[model samples]
Target chain A: MASTGAVTFWRSAGMTYNAYSNICAAIVRNCLKEPYKSEAVTRETVHFTTTNWENGIQGKPVTHEIFK
Target chain B: MAMAAMRREGRRLMVISPTVSLNSTNAVRSPLVSQELSLQGTRSISTQIVRTRMKSVKNIQKITKAMKMVAASKLRGVQVRTEQSRGLWQPFSALLGDIPSMDVKRNIVITVSSDKGLCGGINTTSVKVSKAINRMNSGPEKETKYVILGEKGKVQLMRDSKKDIEVTISEIQKNPLNYTQVSCLADDILKNIEFDALKIVFNKFQSVVQFLPTVATILSPECVDAASETGGKLEGLNSYEIEGGDSKKEILQNLTEFQFSCVMFNAVLENSCSELGARVSAMDSSSRNAGDMLDRLTLAYNRTRQASITTELSEIISGAAALTG
Candidate 1:
């Protein structure tokens, strides 16, 4: 009876592990790809420019020539 | 005597590490007995459960892949606009410096964020800044009006504050920002009511994983003047007056509009980039978490399998001995 219970538990565990592995593999391959990756890049670029502008304008000399 | 010795060794191994001992004992202790058949039945059921779980994982992967692709396409447009707007900042600041300051009664703050989520804390950070501003302005019973970009920000602000949200625009795309819409918004602010100042709050994308929330005074002549003076001082160049046919008022009018539009353009670009960065980081973390879960589940499965095999062998050995004796 003890042996039978142990066998049942192992069998169930093995099945669950196999299922979990499949799901993880799918996530890595499908969802985190090209367009999604590129989208992140684009957002970073926008952030860079805005922050730079904010810093540059904080307190600088105004040359009238640049306006011309 | 040999069988007794083998059993003793197995018992010792089991004492040291039960899981490893269980695996070894299962195979060694197996006997040709009716009890062994029962162990086989349990194994089959466990296998079926594993198969079902694997199917669900596959389905989840497909959805994540689709979302990633969509985010990538939108990112391209966002990148282009952000780059183009880089040159506009200095000029816009210079123009702002030229505008004369005025004392007004009302103030409006335009906040840019994203309508959709999954791009991490971009919307949250923007909202936090806006909320802070709102609190600072609200005294006794007075409220500050908000011109919010993106449905998420609008919804969040409305839910939290539920006060003086002037306008919420939700139709803007991710990139190659539509200055036309921004212009319309600026115009509305300028014409509808008399405002003392105009401020813009947005995300300033620093890197792949760093997006800093920033607040800028958009309509303040003082900030513009400060920007101009800083730009000049940095270059170590002396200031000179414009020597052209254009009159002061004409120049001021042109400069003011230019400054406003440019600032609007910059804000949009920054907000988009921050949104993208936030999403990427969020997705990366999600992937890692999935990996961790897989590892734990795999370990559990292995342990359970070993336990089951050990039980089966013990039952078989006892049954065989009983039959023979």
Candidate 2:
């Protein structure tokens, strides 16, 4: 009985530790470079051509030349 | 006698068992309830944070989408220019390759990031890469300097480093990477210090969701050499060698200038894509977290209500029994 109880406790503790470690690792990975990449891409895509909002045409033009 | 003793022991144990269980249960439950309440408090705080983050994420998404549309619109023009410039770089690189004994003394890294926040880890990753590079160059043989393109990069570097920082240009407009800006930055770097290698660190846009952090070597005669060698191989295969003059130094200078512009253009595209992806993901997580908290809170509220009702019923039954007695 005693041996069985000890085995059960050890198994539960190990499982909990593994779960916690996995969660921490995931949080670190998700919060790191991913956000920066997305932001950088968005900025590049939207603002690459328009330098000044006042002078540049607002909204994408439908019938503009494909290349300058 | 054995049966009588056994009966007494069994009764005593039975009596002791409930008391033990009641005490133990109370002991366990008190802490568990306290922990539950603490969890509730944390959940509330997390919910508030999620709400604020959601708002910000939505705003960023709007901006990113707008930016994506803009990039799509301008991509054709940028692609054309880039393709045209590739032809010009061929002869230039062959010249630089021919000159084997050029002096290389220092390395300078120009890091481009955004002035704004909420785009995500684009700036942070760039800064981390820069720090790693700086640490690598801490050896006696090499010296590294920084030319920052965004306010965020400047702020991050300033917090930890006390090295020689050259120019910092912030609030760059979203224009087709102006050759003039690249030239000005290049001229400043060239005039101020003698560097053997120049690297431009920025995000390279692969897709809306994937932006790769790239370290492009902008001012290396080695690039021209590689281009020439590659060009020669292609020409041999197709029966045409690249037509260009033998002024390797002049060609190298021109190639370096063109390389700077390409690096800038690539960086801008990458950073914008990264920004959009971060905002979309952040918002998605926020909405899911909010839903989870609401479910947990509803369960706790129901459990507490049920416990109170059971207590009231038990108290009324005990009062009625006392009255009957």
Chain B TM (all candidates): 0.70, 0.54
Top candidate by DockQ: 2
lDDT of 2 by residue, B53-89 (tens): 5556556656655654554555545545544544543
lDDT of 1 at B230: 59
Regions more than 4 Å wrong, model 1: A1-68, B1-58, B69-77, B97-104, B139-143, B174-176, B188-194, B220-250
User: What root-mean-square deviation over C-alphas does model 2 reach?
Assistant: 24.8
Worst 10 residues of 1 chain B by lDDT: B96-105
- Quote the true-contact fraction of every model: 0.00, 0.02
Candidate 1: CAPRI quality band: incorrect
Candidate 2: CAPRI quality band: incorrect
Q: Pick the candidate with the highest TM-score.
A: 1
